[model samples]
Structures are given as C-alpha cells and as structure tokens.
Target: MRNLVILGAGTAGTMMANHLISKLPKKEWKITIVDQYETHYYQPGFLFLPFDIYTTKQVKKKGSKFIPKDVRYIQEKIELIEPEKNVVQLEKSGELAYDILIVATGTKIAPEEIDGMAGPEWYKSIFDFYTYEGAKALRNKLREWEGGKLVVHITEMPIKCPVAPLEFAFLADSYFKNKGMRDKVDITYVTPLGGAFTKPKATKALHHLLEEKGIKEVTDFNIERVDYENKKIIDYADIEIEYDLLVTVPTNIGDALIERSGMGDDLNFVPTDKATLQTKDYENIFAIGDATNLPASKAGSVAHFEAEILEENILRYIKGEPLKAEFDGHANCFIETGGGKALLIDFNYNHEPVEGTFPFPGIGPLNLLKESRMNHMGKMAFRWIYWNMLIKGISIPFVSAKMSEKGKHLEETV
Candidate 1:
C-alpha cells in the first residue's frame, strides 16, 4: 500500500485528509496525520475572545474528532523533516516514510521576533489574541478594567486572518460602549500599511468606519521595537505610541521545521506555485493554507477554497496527469463592525473588493462592502458551518473556488 502523510492537523490538513479519504481507494492507500497538540482551535474566533463573544470551549475541539477514523492520527512533536529521504522524524516515535506528503504546518505568531514584546509585560498589560492562552488572558484583563487608551497594533503583515486586528478594534469599541465606558476609553489602530487594510477600496471604507467610531488610525508606522518600560512602541520613523492596554498581532512565521528542512523562504513559508498549490521545488509534495507563501489572504476561507481545487489536483498527480492551475487566490471575509452588524468582502488576485450581493447575484442574504444585520448573522453562522460542512470537505453551494465578478463593480484591477 502507498503511504500518504500529512504534517499538521489544522484546518487545511484536516480538510485535505477528509477529502482524500473519500476520493482515494482505501485498499490501496494508508493515510497518517501528525500534530503535537490534541485540540484544534477555531482561530478566527480568537478575535472575539477579548470581547467575550466566544469562550474557550466554543472555539476548541479535539483534533481526533475532526480526523477521520480511517486515517491514522499521531499526536507527537515533529523534530524534523527529511525531505530528501521522504521521511518524517518525530520526537518520540521512529521515522515514517511516505509516498506522498502534504505540508500544512500552518503559520504561528512569533512574539519573540519583536524585542520586549514577549518580555515582562506579556499577558499582563501586553496581550495577543492570536493564541488561546493570550485571548483568555486578555479577557481577564478586559473584565475588571475601568478603561483607558487601548492600542490594537499589527507588528507585521501576512498574519492569519488579515482583517482580524481591525475586527478586534471594532469589537472593542462596541464592548466598551455596551459597558457604558465608551467615553472613558480611547482606541487606536496602528499598522505598517498606509491604511486600515491592505486592499485599496476596502481601506477607504474601513478608514471611514474608524473615523466615525472615534478610533484613531496610525498608518505607515513600521514598528522598531516595543518599549515595555515606557509602555510605548517605537517605530522606525521614531514615532512613539503609548498605551494602557496593548493588543498586538506580532510577526507571523511558519513552523520552525520548515526552516530546519531548508524548504522555505525568508519568512519560513514554503514557496508554492501560485496556481497549482504545489511546492516549487518538489513535485510530490504539496502545500496549503498559511504554510504556503502564496500571495493571498491567510484566512480560513482561503484554505476551504484551496482544498476543493487541491483535491482534484492531488488526484491528477497520482494518475500521472498534468496538474490543473486552478487556485486563483480567491478570498472572502466578514468584517464584524459590532452593534449586531457586519460587512462582507469578496475578491481574488486580480480584483479588489466591491459593493454588491454575495453567494448570489442581486439576491444575496449577505451584502458586500455594506454593513448589515444579515451579514452579522452569516458571520456567526459560519462557526456551525465550519464544524459541520467545511471540515468534512463538503463544498459550500454557490461559492466557487474562483471569485465571481458578476455582482461586483470592478473599475480597477487588483
């Protein structure tokens, strides 16, 4: 039997395992998934953790639950990957060889990359919502607090869920207002980008929302270091921003194993074919999700869309056929504006987000680039879909892998 090994059991790896199990013949193939942790986190829900929108229980589940019974699940730390020998070395277990390998070891937040960011103040006054522990810590800090200058900053880009930091700022505004402390607190969003978001049109809309909500935006500020002693962040331009509570999204990098294996780029992200989702250097190895250095938003929806196309491409590879260049960097996200409303944005590599209907042209229950209660409902409902349909490799109806331009107004190409 041919052995297939998956590196991580995160969203991307889980979906690929489930999808492949159904497509590949069980009699001819043996599948194995490896991960150090037992629980699988709903990373997007991390953004709402500080606002008490989602509890730890609501956003976490055992990795074994989502993994299929047919596939072998190994819970252990990965020491290194012997790519040349086509084997994986675990910390405790012996080496395991594979006929095909999938590298889905996702990106992680490296707070240590920023000086003093993870020093004495970590989880006390300095917090990050990217991890479950940090989110829980932030929740405790936000709970008995009278309110002051709260700074939401992004240390760098290519972080998971690019819009999450902005969403956190919006949610904080709502949370403080609901507590009747809106007047007592001031919120500031700092980023290296020139605007609120990476995309141009969305940035304009987001900038307006920030201004209207009384949230300050400090743009184009490349952080030099965090001065924890002074409770301030020093940027490359020598600008200093002080804060009482700092919620930062630190620099995100791929798994350290990627660096050990010498198969990754400067940021440790595996160089993947933008169209095929296959590693640039290895024909038998594939990459997905935040693991790949694809020029796309590092979000869960992107992984879901990539899995659909990758499933087919994997089959084609086994048959010795030409792999389809189907992935289009399609990504869509719901920006929670709080107040029981949200806005949705849909775009791909060649197009920016525009105002229109979504999943249905001219008849969407969710509107694009416009805040609506329906969009909020859709955002909340996604958690259910993620557990039931998405991880099970069930394709979402009406949502194509390539973004549709039918409902959007595209005046300029991305």
Candidate 2:
C-alpha cells in the first residue's frame, strides 16, 4: 500500500488528514500524522485569554479528538526529514517512509531571537499572547495592573494571524474601559510596518481606529533590542519606548525539522508554489498554511482556503495529471475595534480590501471594510466554526477557495 505521511497536527495538517482520508482509497493507501503536542490550542482565542474573554479550558482540546480514527496519530517530536530518501526520522518512533508527504508543521515564535526578550522580565513585565502559557500568564498580569503605559509591540512580521496584535490592542482598550481604567492606561502600538497593516486600504481604516481609540501609533520602527534593565525597547534609530507592561509579538519561524530537512527557505518555511501550494523543488511534497513561504496572511482562513485547492491538486498528482495553479491568496479577517463593534476585510493577491457586503453582493448580513455589531458577533462565533467545521475539513457554505469580486468596490485600490 502507498503510505502518506503528514507532519504536525495543527489546523492545516489536521484538515489535510481529514480531507485525504475521505478521498484517497483506504485499501490502497495508509495515512499517518505526527506531532509532539497532545493538546490543540484554539490559537485565535489566545487574543481574548488575557482579557478574560476566553478561559483556558475554553480554548484547549485534545489533538486526537479532532483527528479521524481512520488516520494513525503518532505523538512524537520529529528529528529530521530525509526528503530525498522519502523518509522521516522521529525522536521516539523509528523511521517512517511515505509515498506522499505534507509539511504543515507551522511557525513558532522565537522570543530569544531578540536580545533580552526572554530575560529578567519574561512573564513579568515582558509577555506574549502567541502561546497558551504566555496568554495565561499575561492574564494574571493584566488583572492586577491598575493602570500604566501598556506597550503592544511587534518584533517582526510574518507572524501567525497578522491582525492578532492589533486585535489585542483593541481588546485591551475595551478591557481597560470596562474596568474603568481606560483613562489611566496609556496604550501604544509599535510596529515595523510603514502603516498599521500590510494592505493599504485596511491600514488606512485601522489607522483611524487607532487614533480614535487614543492608542499612540509608532510606525517604521525596526526593533533592535529590548533594554530589560531599563524596561525599554530601543529601535534601530535609537528611539526608546518605555512600558510598565510589554506585550510583544516576536519573530516567527517554521519547524526545526524543516531546517534539518534542507528543503526550506532561510526562515525554514518550505518553498511552495504561490498558486498551487506544491513544494517548488519536490514533486511529491506539498506545503500549506504558515509552513509555506507564501506572501499571504498566515491566518486560519488562508489554510482553510488552501486545503480545498490542495485536496484537488493531490488527487491530480496521484492520477499523474498536471496540477492547477488556483490559489488566489484569498484572505478574510475580522478586526476587533473595541466595544461591541468589529470590521471585516476580504481581498485576494491583487485586490486590496474594499467596502461592500460579504458572502452576498450589496446585501450582506456581514459588512466588509466597516465596523458593525454583527461583525463583532461573527468574530465571537468563529471559534465554534473553527472547531466544528474548519479542522474537520468541512467546506464552508458560500465560501470559495478563490476570492470573488462580487462584493467589493474595485475603484478604491490604494
């Protein structure tokens, strides 16, 4: 029987497992998924954890629960990938061979990459919400903080859920306001980008929200190192920002196994076809989600969209057919704007986010590029959808892998 090996049991890998098990012939193929962790975190919920919007129990689930019984689940750390030999070496389990391989071992935050980031003040004054432990620790810190200068900074980009840092800022604004400490807490948003976001139209809208919320914005600031001794972050330009509590989104890189495999970019992300999700150098290998060096937002939505396209391509490859370049970099994100309001943006590789309706043209239950109460509800409701529909490889109704121009205004391109 042909063997199919998948790395990582995260969103992308889990979805691919479910997608393939249903399509690939069970009698002719054997499937196995590997990951070191037993629990799967609802990573998006980490943003709300510090604010007490989501408790620890609400965002945690067994990794095996979501994985199908038909697929063999192996819990072990990967040592290396011998791509040329079509085999994988695990720290605990022995070597495993595969006829087809999927690399979905997603990116991880490397706080130590920055000087003094993981030093003296780590989990004290310095905190991160990208990990479950960090989020839980920050929750305790925020609860005790009466009021002070709160700096939310990004050490670098290409991090998972690019909008998460901004979401945290917005949520903090709402959190402190609810606690009657909004006036006492001074919030600052620091980023290396020239604006609030990568997309121009979205940045303009988000910039306005930052100004309106009284959150100080510092752009084009390349972080050099964290002066832990003085409780400051100094940019390359020698500009310093002081904070009582520092929430950082550090540099993110792909799995170490990819680096050991020698089939990845400088950052360890697999070099993938921008449109096909196929590994550029390996015909039998594929990459999805944050594992790929795709110039797209490393969000769950992108993975969900890519899964559909990849399912098709994998089938074609097995049939000895040419692959289709169909991925359009379609990404839709919900931006929490404090209070009971949030905004949604939908766009593709070439189109910037524009104002209109979503899921339906001109008459959406959800508005695009505009903040509304419904959008906030939609954002809150996504966690349920993520667990029940997304990771299960269930196709979302009315959502296509390719982006549609039906709802957006094209003339407002920035």
Candidate 3:
C-alpha cells in the first residue's frame, strides 16, 4: 500500500483526511496523520472564551476522538519536512516517507515578533485573545477590572479570523453595558489598515457599526513597539496610544517546520498554487488552510470551502488529469455586532460583501451583510456544526463550495 501522510490534524488536515478516506481506493492507499498535541481546539471559540460565552472544556477535545480508526494517528512533534526527499522527520518516529504529502500546519500568533509586546506586561496589562492561554488570562483580568481605557488592536493583517479583534471591541461594549460600567470604559480600535476591514464595502458597514457602539478608531497606525512601562504602544511615526488594557492580535505566521524545510515564504507560509492547493515546488505536495499563502481570508469557512476544492484537485492529480482551477476564494463570516445580533458577509475574489439573503435566494432565514438575530443564532450554532458536521467532512446543507451570486444585491466597483 502507498503511504499518504498529512501534517497537522487541525481543522483543515482532519477534514482532508475524512474527505479522502471515502474517496481513495482503500486497499491501494494507507492514510496517516500527524500532530504534536492530543487536543484539537475550536480556535474560533477562542474569541468567545474571554467573554465567558464558551468554557475551556467547550473549546477543546481529544484529537484522536475525531480521527478515523482506519487511519494511522501519530502523536509526535514534526521536526522538519524534507520536501525534496518527500520525507518528513519526526522527533521520535524518525523519517516518514510519503507518496503524497498534505501540509495543514496552519498559522499561529507570533507575539514575540513584536518588540516589548510579549515583555514584562504580557498576560498582565498586555494580552492576546488568539490563544487559549491568552483568552483565559484576559477573562480573569476582566473579571475584577474596573473600567478604563481598553484598546483592541491588530498588530498586522493576514491574521486568523481577521474580524475577531473588532468583534472583541463590540462585545466589550455590550459586556460593559451589562456590567453597568459602560460609562467608565473607554474603548478604542487600532489597526494597521486605513479602514475597519480589508474589503471596501464591508469596511464602510463596519465603520458605521463601530461609530454606533461609540468605539474610537485609529487607522494607518503601524506599530513600532510597545512601551510596557508607560502602558502605551508607539507607532512608526512616534504616535502613541496609551491603554489600561491592551488586547492585541500579534503577527500571524505559519509553522516553523515550513521554515526548517526551506519551502516557505518570509512569514513561513508555503507558497502553493492558489487555485489547485498544490505546492508550487512539488505536485505531490498540497497545502490547505492558513499554511498556504492564499489571498483568501484566513478563516475556518475559507478552509471548509478550500477542502472541497482541494479533494477534487488531489483526486485529479492522482488520476493524471489536468487540475481544474475552480477555487474562487469563496469565504463567508458572521461578524458579531454585540447585543444578540450579527452581520453575515459572503464574498469571493471578484466580489465584496453586500446585503442579501444566504443559502436561500430571496427566502433566507439568514440575511447577508445585514444585522439580524437569526445570524447571531447561526453563529452560536456553528460550534455544534464544527464538531459534528464540519471537521467530519460532512457537507453542509444548502451551502455549496463555490459562492452563489444570485441571492446577493451586487454593486459595481468604482
């Protein structure tokens, strides 16, 4: 039997395993997946962890539980990937050669990338909600905290779940109000970008929401360093923003294995064919999720969509057929605007998010690019879908891999 190895058993890799298991010839191929830790985290839940919306127990589970018994599950640290040799080196298991390799190591927050950001004040006045430890720390900090200047910041773009920081700000607004301390809290949002979001249309809608919630915005602020002693973050132009509590999403980079293998870019992301999900260097090597330097949003929904397209492409490669460039960067996300409401946005490479119905055209119980309680319910319900349907490679009902433009009210770009 030929060996097919998967690196990282996160959302992307796990889904790919499940997808390929049923599709590949069982007797002809052997599937093996590798991950260092035993726990599989619902990373999206990290955002809700700080707000006490989800408990620690809710966000994690035994990784082995979701993996198929038919597949080999190796819990070992990946030392390096020798792509040229088509072999992966593990800490204790030695080198594992593969007929095909899939890299799904995903992106992680590199707090240390920013000077003084992870210094003496880390987990004290400085915190990040991107990690489990950081989210729990921030939760504890907020428990007894009297109101003060709260800064929700993004150190840079290309971070996982880009809308999360903004969601944090919105939730803080609601949280403080619920605590009867809204008047005492000063909320500010700081970003490296000139607007609230990457896309043009969504930014306009988000900017209005921020304004309505009384959250201040400081844009075009490229952070230089954090002055921990002064409790202020200084930008390149020397502009400083003082904060009582600094919650930030630091620089996000791919796994170190990519760097060790010398197959990744400056940020350690593997350069893959955006459409095919195949490594530019090796046709047998594929990448998904945050591991690939795709121009799509680094969100779980994007991974879910990419997984569908990738499975088809991989099958095509195995059959020696020309791969179809069908991936259109389809991504959709629910932005929590607080107060039991959320706005859903769907878009792809050529389109920006706008108001419309979703999954069902003109009859959506879920509205797109518009705030609704139904969207909020959909967001809350996703955790269940993630564990039961999503990671298991079960296709979602009514949600096609490629985005549908029929339901949307499209607008021409200026």
Candidate 4:
C-alpha cells in the first residue's frame, strides 16, 4: 500500500478525507491527516460571536470527530515539507513519506506584522474577532464598557471573509440601537478599498445601506502604524483616525512552514494553477481553500465547490491521465446587515453579483444581491447545513459545482 498524506484537517482537508475514503481503494491507498491543533472551529460562526449570537460551544469541536475512522489522524506540528523527496518533517513525531500530498493549511491573522499592533494596548483597546480568544475578549469589553468612538477597520485586503468588517459595523449599529445607546456611540468604518465592497453592484448597494445606518465610511486609507498611546491609526499619507474602541482585521498570511519549505509565494500561499489547484512547482502537491494563491474569495463556499473538481483531478493523476482544469472560482457568501436582515451574493470568475433569485428561477426562498429577512433566515440555517451536510462530503442539492446562468440576471455592459 502507498501512503497519501494530507496536511491540516481544516474544512478543505476534512471534506477531502471523506470524499477520498469512499472513492479510493482501501487496499491500495493508506491515507493519513496531520494537524497541530485539536479543535475545529466553525469559522463563519466567528462573525456572530462578538454580537453574543453564538457561544463558544457552538463554534468548536474536536478535530478527530469529523475525521473518518478508516483514515489515520495524527496530531503534530509540521516543521518542513521536502517536496523534492516527498517527505514531511514533524516537530514532535518523526518524518513521513508520501506518494501524494494535499496541502490544505489555511491562512491566519498576524497582528504582530504591524508595528505597535501587538504592543501594550493589544488586547486592551485593540481587538480582533478573527481568533477565538480575541472574539471572547471583545464580547466582554462590549458588554460592560460605555460606547464612544467605535471604529471597525480592515488593516489590509486578501483577509479571511472580506466582508466581515462591514458586517461588524452593521451589527454594531443594531447592537447599540438595541442597547438604547445609539446616541452615545459614534460608529465609523475604515477600509483600504475604494468602496464598501470589492464588487461594483454589491458595493453600490452596501454603500446605500451604510448611508442609511449613519455609519461613516473612510476609504482608500492604507494603514502605516498603530498609535497605541494616543489611540490613533496613521495611514501612509499622514492621515490619522482616532478611536476609543478599535475592532480590526489584521494582516493575514499563510503558515510559516510554507515559507520554510520554499513552496509558497510572497504571502506564503502556494503558487497554484488557478483552475487545477495543482502547485506550479510540484505536480505531486495540490492546494485548496485559503492555501492557494487563487484569485478567489478566501471563503468556505469556494472550497466546497473546488473539492469535487480536486477529487476528480487527483484520481486522474493516480491513473497517469491528464488532469482536468474544472475549477471556475465559484464563491457565495451571506452579508449580515443587522436588524434581522441580510444579503446574499453569488458569482464566479467572469461575473459580478446582480439582482436575482437563488437555487431556483423566479422561485427562490432567498433573494440575491438584495436585503431581506428571508436572507437572514438562510444565513442562520447555513450553520445546520454546514455541520450535517457539507463536512460529510455531501453535495448541496440543486447547486452545481460550476456557476449557472439559469436564475441569475446579468448586468448590462457598456
């Protein structure tokens, strides 16, 4: 039997494990998954943690729970990946050789990369919701403290869940209103983007919502340093924004081991073919989710769509056949706009989000690129679907891996 080693038992790795176990011959392929951490976080649930919408118990579980019994699950830190020799060095455990390697190690927030960000005011006034500890701390601070100048900021782009900062601002608007202190707090949104979002249509719609909510928008502001003493953030152009309580999304980068292995790009993401997800440097190694330097959102939906195509390509490679480039950067996300309402957006590489119904033509229970209470319900329902259906490698009914034009309304081009 030959060994197949999968790194990082996150969303992508877990799904791949389930899919391959059923398809690959057990006698021929002996699969093993490795990760340093034991807990599996429901990453989307992090957005709701600061608002008290979700508890710690709801977002965490043992990593071994999702991993199949048939596959060998090893909990150890990876020291290096010797791609040329097909071996991975572990920090505590010994080295393991693999016939095929799947790299699913995801990106992480690195606040230390910014000067004065991890300083004295790190967890005091400055906080991030990207991590479990940060989210819990922010929750406690928001409860007891009286609101003043509250700023929701994004340090840089290519961050996990790009719309999360906007969601935080929107939810904070509703949170303060419910607390009867909307007049006491001043909420401001600061981003490096030109508008509220990346996509044109979605940005226009979200801009309207921001205006309606009375949340101030500061755009094109590239951060330079954090002024912990004065509670101000300075941009490259000498512009400054002061805040009483700052909730920021820090700079995100791939695992350090990737850089040590010389298998990653400037940001430590593996150089991968956009469609095939196979690493450009090594044919035996492939990446998925936030591990690949693909021009797609670092979101879970994209990983789910890519898993099907990746499984097929892996099989083709095993048979010495040509691999199929089937991935099309399909991504879908739900934007929580507070006040018991949300918006849904779905698009691929060639299309931007437009107004329409989803998963059905003119008969969707949910609307796209538009705000509705039903959309909020759909966002809430996803947690159930994620745990019960997605991790099990079960495809969502009526939703194809590829983007469809059936229920979508295309925008008019000039």
Quote the lDDT for 148 in model 2. Answer: 89
Which parts of model 2 have CA positions greater than 4 angstroms off?
A: 411-414
Models 1 onward score TM values of 0.99, 0.99, 0.99, 0.98
Q: Is candidate 1 or candidate 4 better by lDDT?
A: 1
Q: What TM-score does structure 3 among the candidates reach?
A: 0.99
Clashing pairs in 1: none
Question: Which portions of model 1 show Cα errors greater than 4 Å?
Answer: none
Q: Which has the higher TM-score value, candidate number 3 or candidate number 4?
A: 3
Give candidate 3 regions above 4 Å deviation: 412-414
94-195, model 3: which lDDT tens digit per residue? Answer: 999999999999998898998999899999999999888999999999998998999999999889988999999999999999999999999999999999
Distance (Å) between predicted and true CA of 210, model 4? 0.7
RMSD of each: 0.9, 1.0, 0.9, 1.2
Clash counts for all predictions: 0, 0, 0, 0
Candidate 4 residue 110 C-alpha distance from true site, Å:
0.7
lDDT of 1: 0.93
